[model samples]
Target: MSNVLNTFLDENLQDLRTQGLYNEIDPVEGANGPIIQVAGKQLINLSSNNYLGLATNDELKKIAQNTIETYGVGAGAVRTINGTLDLHVKLEQTLAKFKGTEAAISYQSGFNCNMAAISAVMDKNDAILSDALNHASIIDGCRLSKAKIIPFAHADMDDLRAKAKQATESGLYNKVMVITDGVFSMDGDIAKLPEIVEIAKEFDLITYVDDAHGSGVTGKGAGTVKHFGLQNEIDFQIGTLSKAIGVVGGYVAGKKNLIDWLKVRSRPFLFSTALPPGDVAAITRAVEIIMESTELHDKLWDNGDYLKKGLIELGFNIGDSETPITPCIIGDEKLTQQFSKRLIEEGVYAKSIVFPTVPKGTGRVRNMPTAAHTKEMLDDALAIYAKVGRELGVIQ
Candidate 1:
């Protein structure tokens, strides 16, 4: 390795450590669920994205095991080659039904879905109006498209409308797309999809929604588009099988033409190997479960409410959150990281988010309450929270 490259890496890593921006990953010893084990200690985990607790579901596991037994583990080659498994086809079909779209195309991950689909449709001649609080993957996708990205205020319909009008009237591009997250992961706010759709129609803009955190949690588990009854109005609905679905993959559900185009034009699908048979089977089973009932969905919201109420009663400022995602805001970055570290020591595993992730000084310890958590577990976790909040001078 060159000395210059080594120095650059070493300097940046040292800076991250000194500034408290370096993330230390803790590995889970077993299956991820309502509770998890880390560093030989059991914790009431609030850091996982397993919103519905489906990641370790018995039924899903059995299906996956059976699939692995029958089909082997891997999908051999890329989708464009011999890797388009019958299971993959079924998974896409089931996802389409769950999303209430004409068709769907699958990708290796949610990040890949955005990276592949955005550039496949838009290019340098197009412009994209993105929400300021949009996910990093969406930002990366817009950049990959080589489109002129214009960021509007987070969920501000008026701002979006003005930008849409300006971008279209300028006659600067062949196409314009408006993109946002259905549910903002950090603040847990739901996007104004109905208003966005109305604005899109007025300006003839292509609407894209990355419903990663919304799927299997909102819209009776159909996501934000279906939550607002605008499934057909939105041009693109992107989702993840990893988050609420509790599996591993991503998808884009939309009109048949869009699906067909993505299938052919998306580089990841054409290049990367397809999802393993077991994962595909597991995802198919998971989507079917989400479609068949709302028991888990209701329980998830119940747990969320219970946790939020407990935290509020204890005087913790969990900012304005419309979903189960709760952020325990700690103003200073160093204090925020300390709070999270203290929580882990106290047997809760919520993580901290600070600068470069959220705006400076808005550091927070984010919590994700899931369906599998019992009232007893939440009660215990809340007791720990009160202890830590007082210890850190974050509460009375």
Candidate 2:
């Protein structure tokens, strides 16, 4: 390696270590479930995005196995070539129905979905008004579009309205779009979509919502857009099959013309190999399961409320989370890392989240309470938290 590259790497590595911001990954021994085995230790898991416990659901596993046996492992080619299988078609149809859209298109992963969808629609001729705290994917996508990106304060509807008015009335761009995450994962706050929609209508701005964290958790499992009954009002409804759906892929659900355009113009769909047949089949069934009943959704909320209440009673700052995603805020970066490390040592697997995932001095241990967690498991985890918090002087 070149001396300059080596020096850059060494300096950055030492800087991260000194700041306690370098994250060391732990390998889970088996399936990621309510209880996970990490480094040969059994720990109650509060770090997984398996919101409905469908990642380990027996029925979905069986479906995947059976489909793989019939269709083989891979999708063979890109969708524009020969990779579009019957299962892929079925999955898109199911996603459209699930999202209450006229049509839908699937991609390899949620991150790629954003990269493809955003650039496909908005371009240098357009301007985008994005939420300040959106996921990194959205930020990158906006950058890729070459569109003028104007950021609004997180969930500040008045700020969004003002920006929309300025961008749309300026006549400097052909179009202006407003985009946000359906659920703010770090603090677990629901986006003010209803108010956003109202602003969009006033300024005739195109609306885009990435509900990666909200689908199958809110709106009776349909998503945040449906939760507000604004399916027709929003132009782009983006989601991930990996998180709440407990599978691996991403999709855009919207009107038929938008779906048609994405199919042709979205680079990921046109270039990347399609999602595997087995995964596609499993995703379809998972959507059906979520749509069929709200049993898992109700249980997930129950667990979230239980855990939040416990943490609040024990004097922890959980922020204002409206969904099952919870965060235990520890303002100091080193202390937050120490708290998470102690939790792992004490047999709880919640991980520390710090900059640049979140702003500096707002480090947190983000907890994801799923439908799979039992009361006993939550009680045990809460006890461990109390012990750790007291030991760290984070609580009385």
Estimated TM-score per prediction? 0.98, 0.99
Report RMSD (Å) for each prediction in the order shown: 0.9, 0.6
Cα lDDT computed for each candidate against the true fold = 0.94, 0.95
lDDT of 1: 0.94
**Per-residue lDDT over 154-249 for candidate 1, one digit per residue giving the tens place of the 0 to 100 score:** 989999999999999998999999999999999999999989989999999999999999999999888989999998899999999999999998
Candidate 2 lDDT (Cα, whole model)? 0.95
- lDDT (Cα, tens digit) per residue for candidate 2, span 10-50: 99989998898998899999999999999999999999999
Number of the top lDDT candidate: 2
Query: On a 0 to 1 TM-score scale, where does candidate 2 land against the true structure?
Result: 0.99
